[model samples]
Target: MANIPAFKLNDGNEIPSFGFGVFQIPADGTTYKAVSDALKLGYRHIDTAAAYFNEQEVGKAINDSGIPRDQIWVTSKMWLQDYAYEDAKKAIDTSLNKLGLDYMDLYLLHQPYGKVDEAWRALEEAQKAGKIRSIGVSNMSPKLWKKWAPSFNVTPAVNQVEFNPYFQQQELRDVLADSHVALEAWAPLGEGNQDLFNEPVLKSLAEKYGKDVGQIILRYEHQLGVIVFPKSVHEARIKSNAEIFDFELTSDEMDALRKLDKGKGMHDPDAPGVADTLLNAFDIHAND
Candidate 1:
């Protein structure tokens, strides 16, 4: 097993620096196998969510892998429909039941919308009851942070968002740094943007380091104190994504990659209509 690094959260819990995500991965056998392969490749962290609809498969893979539960880190989120106080409380239990776990290592409010205050209160209550180790929010902006920070009894341990070479999120980084909250990158590979892979700087860095463009981007973000979990169903790609800890990028090289930030991401939570679109678009609870 590779000696992967970990980042300490504000709440003092640590998360594996590199892991696997099951965002678009289907539930049927695919998520289970991908998660199993990732564990075999020494990935101790597995990121999933209620909206992803694959927690059962993830749980099955983890349970069958024979790795002790404490050796692995699992994360799930509360969906928009479950934002009410009671709904949020039940949602957490539902995730636990589906994942077949007694507790979750980390849990997040999936978005910045809905009855956020009520939902966050539920998360806090769950943490107190030992159902969740660390509680946080995803896709939150500074504005939204301000809206809820003053009222929060427990500070968010992390803020996961769409981050990549093209959208570095320097402002959010500074904000999170000030509060000692970890930043986890979701689209850390630029979601396979052709322009990003074809960029001269990234290409040159890959050549210099004898790695692929994906590796270069992931390593850059990792060096910047950002945690990343690049999702891929392919076994080879899952293995390749974990090969970043062996190399380090120098200051100038880090600066070169930092300059690629375009100051925006694919989805802007602060933007108008985004909340409505996300809140109304999906029926994640339909199959239940």
Candidate 2:
């Protein structure tokens, strides 16, 4: 098993350096098998969300794998439909029930919109009640963070966002640093975009390090102290993603990767009418 390093959060909780992400993965035997394989291959952390509709399968995989719940880290998120304080409270319990877990290692607001302050308060209360170990938000920009952070009685422990070589949100990263919030990267591989995979600099680094381009990018993010979780349903790819801890990226190589930033992410959290679109489009219970 790989001894993945853990990064301590501002709240003094330790999160694994790498994890397995379950986004856009179907909630079926496939999810169960993929998660079971990841655990067997040494992934101790698993990320899922209400929107993904796979919490039940993820929980079952963890349980059936016979891994002690304490040895595995589980994270889930609250969707927009349940952003009201009371609704958020119910949503947290719903997620916990769906995952078949008593407490979540981390629970995040799935988006920056809706009743964030109310929803966050609910998260804080849950933490105090021992329902969640840590509480945070995702897809939140620095501007949105600043506007609401002061009102938070319990500061966010992690801020997950789309961070990759192609779209490094340096400004938000800096803000997160100042706030002592850990940056958890969601799409660390640029969603397998051909443009990112075909970059000459990344290819050169991959050849030099005896790794694939994906490994080079993951290693770079690991070197920058960012938390990364790459999603892949394939068994070979899941095993390959965990091979990053064996190597290190040099300062020059890291710099080269930084220069590939396009100064913008593929998704804009601040885009006009984004809240309205997301709120109405996603139904976490739709699959049921």
Candidate 3:
């Protein structure tokens, strides 16, 4: 297997450029097997969320994999219910206990709203106390970050958002770039949108490279310096997603993919009050 590169965080910590995401991994023994399989396939980084309700499964997989703790990178996020300072602290401890780890490689506030300032403060305190190595936010709009950033003692090291060829998030990318915060892409494959799979440009490039269209898309994103975590349950697809290191996308191919941007987001941020109502009404957390 080709080695994946690591990106240096603003705090000087390193994260694997390619990681495995367990966003919708079932909260059961299946999660354990899937994660263990990924680690055995040479993936050092694993991203999960409390909302996934499989932290314990992920932890069990890591522990049973027999990999040394320091060699593995584990990331987890806090949900909105735990946004208060004390509550967030308790959440972190619960995550640690569930993960069976002394410290987390990365911990992010899962959304942009709901006592976010308090959550950020708690993350900062966790870092100071050696419970977490790096801290960031997810699904945050630039406008939200602009209002929230000034209140922080620590700048966010990353912002996880929905990104793909169809929704490149150019404006948010620019804002994050200026702040020196890395952008991490969730749903990097557009949640398996068939249109993306059938794109002529991607098809041509995939044919040229003798790889799948998904590989071409991933290569493009890596070249653009956006971190990606494309999830998979099938062992073949899991292996294929990590095969991005073998090829490179040319400048023209990059440009072709860039033109596909529709300038819209598929997911909405769950801010407090009305935002939560909207998100709940739409069943934002429901698996598609």
Overall lDDT per candidate, in order of appearance? 0.92, 0.92, 0.87
Instruction: Report model 1's TM-score to 2 decimal places.
Output: 0.98
Cα lDDT of model 3 by residue, 191-231, tens digit: 99998899998899999999998999998999999988888
| Over 4 Å off, model 3 | 270-274, 278-288
Residue-pair clash count for candidate 1: 0
The order of the candidates by TM-score, greatest first, is 1, 2, 3
Steric overlap count per candidate: 0, 0, 0
Global fold similarity of model 3 (TM-score): 0.94
Select the stronger candidate by lDDT from 1 and 3. Answer: 1
lDDT of 1 by residue, 34-135 (tens): 999999999999999999999999999999999999999999999988999999999999999999999999999999898999999999999999999999
Query: Candidate 3, after superposition: displacement of residue 12 in Å?
Result: 0.6
TM-scores, each model vs. reference:
0.98, 0.98, 0.94
Error of 3 at 164 (Å): 0.5
Quantify how close model 1 is to the true structure by its C-alpha RMSD in Å: 0.8
**Runs in model 2 lying further than 4 Å from the true structure:** 286-288
